[model samples]
Target: MTNDPLKAAWQTANIPAHDDLQAVVRARGGHPVMSRIRRQLLLEGGCYILFLLVYYDFFDGHRRPLYLNIILVLSVACMLMQHLNGYLLASSALKGPDIFRSLQQKVLQLKQYAWLSVGSRVLGWCGIMVFFCTGITWTNAKYGLLAGAIIIMGVQMAMLWQLWQRRINRIKNTLAELNG
Candidate 1:
């Protein structure tokens, strides 16, 4: 095997050295999806924090029912927690004694978080909708508009599900290849 030209060629392939790879990783993060997740975490977390800061006065949260206010805040809290978990998972994707073990751990964690993430998003959306629509008398136009928003969020949920599927499958395939 050592003397075979094909084996030699494969063994000596021009993979980037560890430091160079690390530098690239530092520049762009591990995977594009992971980077996207991290970016989303920051963006969503920022927006949620902004809403928390301004909701009382700007959104008339002060005049809102105490239960509604609590529900809204709790929903936002769930969303923030979801984002934080995703960010942390993305950051730790490559951190382990070895790549295989690291990815294995990630897949496990991902499986565990899948429902939690989806549930949080759904809860947050429903909570926000409830909080916003509480005082509004629903006309045909209002119902139509709310229906449209609900449809949009439904599509978003499907897309998010697909993204999770892709991310998890890709990592699993990578792990399988490494095992061989």
Candidate 2:
């Protein structure tokens, strides 16, 4: 009854450690999608932090409206939270036991993460929009920045949706196989 795709893939690849299944589990956690997510979190989180530091002047004075300041900061905070959740999920997946129950738990965590990611992206973008709308008097640059942000966020949302679908379906199928 050894119909496990991971096992089959390892055998087909001549990985030579079929008895040490935990190594295979560890290797699976290093999948490209997880790597991409980690890199994205690091890159975006770093850039956002840098942007805040560099633009602290714009946010600090008595000139800025409270709501605008709050919205702008909230947008960055939403992004940070989302990235942190993703990091935690990826780390947990790696630590999970090499068993069907662990796989099931990972699938559930992934489903939760997919929803959280979508919701956070929406909230973050909405905050950005509100910030731009409220701070129109602060700078004409708001319009250009909003437009660019929309395009970037749109592309990112699409990528995230695709990744979510691919990973979720893969895990669901694996779970189904284990259950069936």
Q: Give all TM-scores, in the order shown.
A: 0.77, 0.65
Candidate 1: 10-residue stretch with minimal lDDT: 86-95
Best by lDDT: 1
Tens digits of per-residue lDDT for model 2, 140-176: 6866887887898888888988899899999888888
Candidate 1 residue 157 Cα shift, in angstroms, is 0.5
Model 1, range 1-180, lDDT digits (tens) per residue? 687999899998999888898789778756687778877878888999999999999999999999999999999998999889877766763668998998888888898788778889999999999999999988999999999999999999988888888889999999999999
Model 2 weakest 10-residue run by lDDT: 54-63
Candidate 2: where are CA atoms >4 Å away?
A: 1-37, 58-62, 93-98, 135-159
